[model samples]
Target: MATEAKKSGGIVETIKTVVYALLIAGIFRSLFFQPFWIPSGSMKDTLLIGDFLFVNKMTYGYSYASCPSIRIASLGINIDAKDICGIFDGDNKRLFGSEPERGDVVVFRHPVTGYDFIKRLIGLPGDRVQLKDGVVFINDEPVQLEDAGVFEEAAGPQGPQGLRPRCENGPVGDGGLCVKSRKIETLPGGVSHSILNISEQATDNTGIYTVPEGHFFFLGDNRDNSTDSRVPQAARGVGFVPYENLIGRADRIMFSSAGRSMFAFWTWRSDRYFKAIE
Candidate 1:
């Protein structure tokens, strides 16, 4: 027949141009943008552990887990695309965006393991927060550190080879996960971040947290190894994060890797691709 009907009409027009290019790339990643990956270092050196950012889902208004996976998981919608359009069913707000100051760097939907994490936005909904001995008071003032020094690392209990919550990576136990420390804060709008402390653990002397009403008080510029919100969602940490689990504002990075396999293309990191998440 006419050359097998012209190869079956060029295979049905190449499967309808790949289903119309996957529905225009799923409506351009569910409207506006979203691409995150920095497996974990808890925002180290401002985000490293193989950084790879983008998130800016209209800057703050798109929830329904605003594209983390955009939900549908067997009806539970796990993996950070949390509560799918129901926004946890109480109308958790944030439908038009804006409001998330302090130091920014966020990426949420993790009100207690909904899973997108990524911190930095210290207290805002009623402030009063504290840390005293390790410094970081708000509403009472102390929010301006200096000593930008040590922050070394390398003594694995599993990290750097893939970097993750791997045993919570700290100068923890068995003498292997090395880390040195010092100050480097500066958030009152000026930004200036950096913090580590290999010494005074246990959330570095907390106690006086207030911050309620709409909730939000994150942290994890690696201050003594983060669990966030001063660790307390029944102890799994990252508590007090509502405002409907706000999920955006990571700004830029776009690519990096020390490769434990993201195809391992020569362990990438190529000058940290398009850097700029500060």
Candidate 2:
């Protein structure tokens, strides 16, 4: 009976250790640091598809606290479910001394699908954003662009292995559509980044949009390829983004992989590591 009691005690200790380890990891991932995988080329040339990144959760204050899971009502009607989940035993307020700044790369929950998306903050609250003939303008000041040349041809399976090339690049039909690479010209107020223009003509044309109060205007670095605020209202195109939906700020690229190949972990581009976001 003595031996059996000792064995049971050891087993409980092991279980407690495992639970503590998992809880620590969960807290770190949800609050301070979280890993994100780039699933699309929408931010190409800056952030490639398959680029695994680490977003700094502390950059814009803790969003999970400010925006707790509360069921929102329409006008005066009560809703059944909450759209967001609050942190357990955590204060629902912005305690950290941080705020979203213009030109910062940010991650946020997509208003339409509730999925997370990463984009650069181009226009802040009450700022006017416009695009004309492929040129972006903020408050009537034109955003600059420079020629960065083309991408080097890399040989590989033309499409995902053993799959028909549906719609060109992938099943979503945006594969290889916009391949042109260009250097981004720095805009006024210290905003600068690269952009990819697939076609010579500006496909996304939108009139002046004044960012609403407590909202932001986001745009993908791959301007021509991204479905940003410039799209039509029916497709959930470019518009104001609520502040509560922000997840965090993207600070650095942790690792990058070529194409959609997962097993080719050895083929990760090591030269791009520790590079700062522009």
Candidate 3:
């Protein structure tokens, strides 16, 4: 009888330990860092579809967007950030917030859909932004762009979504090489990064967009492929993201996998582990 009682007590202690550990991890994830997985190729060579990184939440301080949204379809658990931190929503302010710099790679909540979108910050508050001939123009001046050869990848399906790449030289066959023109873009304030050009598209040229006060403009590095601030939110685009919607900045990639599952050890991209985001 005593042995049975001891076994039961030990099981209860183990359960308590696990519960406590999970609670601590949840708090840490909500307050400090939020793990983000690149699910699309909008950022392209800068951030691949399988790249996994931690967004530094502390960099932009706390907001309602800081709360984690947990959704497990199979388990039937759905929780939104607004559900958890709805009390903190509205007023368009963050608790200890600092303005994000232009050219910073940021992940923020979509102003309309509440989905998370990652893009390069382009225009800050009260700045004029536009795109002409595939080059970004900020404050009515074109950003410097230097040719950087071609970015090549397989024409086959990529990542778990099985999405195919859009090539500058396409109708590429299944296993053929897909290519895009690469350029090194130098933003104002001396921040430089790689940008890919697929082909001429409507977003390549735009009317002057004056960023509103307390809002920002963003763009994807994959010039023609991304649906960013250039389009209006009503048309399913992320237009003029609010300051309070900013979640965090993704500074570096922590891990990367080319396969459908991250657990597939052989499919891991060894070169991208712990790579600092440029």
Score candidate 2 by TM-score against the native.
0.78
Expressed as tens digits, the lDDT of each residue in 126-194 for candidate 3 is 999998898888888999999999999889888888888999997798999999999999999999999
> What's model 1's overall lDDT?
0.73
RMSD each, Å = 14.5, 6.9, 1.2
**Each prediction's whole-model lDDT (CA):** 0.73, 0.66, 0.93
How many clashes in each candidate? 1, 2, 0
The digit string of per-residue lDDT tens for model 1 on 1-278 reads 99999999999999999999998886787667767777777667677676767778777776576754544566885444543455443566766867888888888867755777788888999888889778888988988888876655454433345443323334354435555565778877788777665556657788888888877899888776677888779978877887767777887887776656555668777887787877
Worst 10 residues of 2 by lDDT: 159-168
For candidate 2, lDDT tens digit of each residue in 38-80?
A: 7765776678666778878777766543232223455664321
Q: Which ten residues in a row have the lowest lDDT in candidate 1?
A: 162-171
**Count of backbone collisions within predicted model 2:** 2
